[model samples]
Target: MKKTIYKKIHIIGSVGSGKTTLAKEISSLLGIPYYELDNVVWIRNKSGDIRRTEQEREEYLNSILQSDNWIIEGIHNEDWVSNCFQSADLIIFLDTNYLVRTYRIIKRFLKQKLRIEKANYKPTLDIFFKMFKWNRHFEEVGKVNFFNKYVVHKDKIKVINNAKCIKKYFN
Candidate 1:
């Protein structure tokens, strides 16, 4: 069977859902640039991170959407990000297992603390605790919310619960 050519992909999932890792792989394989939605919302600086104004965020996202191809990965499911789902040729919902996500959260925190992993934000104790909360909330609320709100785009949505399954798409 032949695979569809996806120029614009929006990958959504909870923290530690492998969205970034997958985005990078696809971007490298297809030679398409990938973006992290968090980067669009914040201005990262050595001194500290600053939140972008709503207008600025909107404009930044619009610029990417207007491009020829891109892979956007983030956990944001807010109204401000709706256009990304609408414009994407493919919407990947990384329904990674809850236990797996929990493990990743712990492992990631350790790596960040040890300087083995570079984090976009400062890996503080507060943020570490929040990751667990986010994971639980995602399982309890975010998953249902995504399906309910984005049902209109069901035709393009792909629910990936396993990492191994991803290789087939690239092959």
Candidate 2:
């Protein structure tokens, strides 16, 4: 198998599309640090998860971008994260089927609530329902918007529509 030479990687996908899982796997395989966009966007405070200002978010991302090699993964396609996409040696876009993603989202939430798995945020019913809404939004709107925005970087983008295809990357 050919070894992946990419030093800086970015992954974007709909909720439960396995972006985090793939990022972690690639990080372990390449021994590169992995950062989550959600963590950068929201800071955990004594009160709860408070969203950082746009300037704060940019500053947080800048710190990660300064690193020589990193893997960043999230579902965001906002302007604030465009720099990450531009800097990445490889961009992974997971397009898993809606049914599969929905299943994973439900399973993941249950696991997080049961303390079987760890998550960046506290699992609540509100967030759980929002995941479904986000999933739909990604399928209907975000996918088109992402393709449109990143059309210039088509060469660097790897669109993985099947879950099994991702296994080959690590192997």
Candidate 3:
């Protein structure tokens, strides 16, 4: 049976997996507020900093989760974020190809540099390279292992494997 889109949705994926973009789209579609974890984590500056203490972060996340409708998007899979998954009506895991995700990341970097796309924080080439490394490593081990160990139940999990699959989900 097709499940109705939930009031609370959580999107998880490796770096550069388009989680933010998809979250925005889904939020718009569902008329729900969308929160990007990076924005909550980093304070904007010429040099960004992790602005929140653990308590502060937890409080902020708790407030958002308490809302009637929301979409939370991030690569974080820590215990703190597990509540999002446990409470979500739908949990999307994007598994786009490595090269595809890399291309998107590079394009996003260029757009941010050109000011075509605004981010809560700027992306340096160093950060871009680090994201690439993380994405590659995620494909090799991190994401798959996490899924196998923690996401064996598929009742609410939707793995979007390609652009077509993504479009299909929206439709």
Candidate 4:
């Protein structure tokens, strides 16, 4: 068996862009632990999701970064996670089309509501709609900035445009 070269992988993209799914798949293939950023930022309980404080979030993130191998996936490209980008051995940027992302967001929400799919948070209508808004925000603002910010690390960055591209990475 061939060994995977990347020990610490970071995946980022717009909502419904399949960042988490791909992260899970790659983690399984590489036998690396996976961490979802949503899990780091929000604590789910009987009432709802309680946001973690900046310090708490940072501490949690630091613990993961200290580990030898991991695959961290999220839509977050903020200053708080810049360290992950800097430390990652590989960074995957999923760039599926907006239409595909919109469809995925709706499909995922329905699945979550019907208990056909698992989600980190409750599948409320507001959260469903916010997914679209977040997708658009990434398309208009976040995408370009992300590329620009990580241009220096272009050699380590992989832009996945479709499912085939994702499979190629592991195969």
Candidate 5:
């Protein structure tokens, strides 16, 4: 990949919206490290993923933001993560179709359950069902909140449904 023009990139989307996929693609192409918000919120271990304290989460996120280059992706649009949007050289909102996301949720769960895909957490039936609820909530509430909170940074925000568009634009 050529030199990265975008030093800090923040990607936001709901469950199954392809945030991780897009972040990984961009990170690979741009040679920038990517961080998932879930990992920042949890301490992954052999026993189980332990939840991080609020202070710890904030501190961890701050440390990442302090870096010169990074690709941060998550569904979080809360005040705590506002700094990421503000600091990003580019912000991508993966406004994927609701139906497409729903399909992906189902597909992802099945893949994890069948051991075809690796998951950060166990792929339980309960978690699979919760992904649906989370998807709906994001469509109804999180999407709007994300726009309102980051409207000030609209110029740098790219509302995309696919990573292909990003590749074309950024390259």
Candidate 6:
């Protein structure tokens, strides 16, 4: 089988959708830099408050898009990111089952709390509760409407429905 070669890839999905994990795996396999969009969007403090500025976010995203080969993963699909997608060889949308994603989210939170996996910022119970809202947004607003409106390269888009397919896609 001929392997897929994507020089610039964008992974977009909701919270708990495994976007970051999949992006990192794909980036390692393809030998490309992986960027977490949340890192660009929010400035983390040692005290745990996340400050987000649109201008700073834009600049950060601009720097990443200027790179040759990158895997950018995030839930934000604004105009700037959409422009970056124009050059993306592949755009993956992970629509894994809600129960699976919820479990992953909880597992990640516990891992983060245990210091097993370090996040850009600490994950709190408040953030855990917010996952419910994020999941709803992804289902009702983000995925369907955003894809319909902005995702122009239908041929390049791949929607993975499960973790098994995610591994298969990269393999």
Best by TM-score: 1
The parts of candidate 5 lying over 4 Å away from their true place are 1-4
**Alpha carbon deviation, residue 134, candidate 1 (Å):** 1.0
Candidate 6 C-alpha error for residue 51, in Å = 3.1
**Taking the tens digit of each residue's C-alpha lDDT, what string does model 3 give over 21-112?**
88888878779999988766665576566688888888889999999989999887777777888888888888878888888889989999
TM-scores for all candidates? 0.97, 0.94, 0.88, 0.95, 0.95, 0.88
Best by lDDT: 1
lDDT of 6 at 56: 81
Query: For model 3, which pairs clash?
Result: none
The TM-score that candidate 1 achieves is: 0.97
Clashes per candidate (backbone, < 3 Å): 0, 0, 0, 0, 0, 0
Deviation from truth (RMSD, Å), model 3 = 2.2
Once fitted onto the true fold, the runs of candidate 4 whose alpha carbons sit more than 4 angstroms away are 1-4
Tens-place lDDT digits, model 2, residues 77-166: 988899999999999999999999999999999999999998788899999999999999999999999999998889999999975787
**Taking the tens digit of each residue's C-alpha lDDT, what string does model 6 give over 1-171?**
678777899888888888888887887788999988778877778877575677888888888888988999888877757866777888888888888877888888899999998877668788878887888778888887768866568888888886578676666
Q: Which TM-score value belongs to model 4?
A: 0.95
Model 2: lDDT of residue 48: 87
In candidate 1, residue 132 scores what lDDT?
A: 96
lDDT of 4 by residue, 1-171 (tens): 685589999999999899888888888888999999998998778788899999999999999999998999999988899999999999999999999999999999999999999888889999998888999999999998898887888989999887678786677
Q: For candidate 5, give the lDDT of residue 2.
A: 64
Compare candidates 2 and 4 on lDDT and give the better one: 2
Q: lDDT score, residue 6, model 1?
A: 89
Report the C-alpha displacement of residue 106, candidate 3, in angstroms.
Answer: 1.4
Better of 1 and 5 by TM-score: 1
Task: Please give the CA lDDT of all the candidate structures.
Answer: 0.94, 0.92, 0.81, 0.90, 0.92, 0.81
Lowest summed lDDT across 10 adjacent residues in model 2 is found at 162-171
Candidate 5 residue lDDT tens string, 98-121: 999999999999999899999999
**Candidate 1, residue 50: CA error in Å?**
0.4
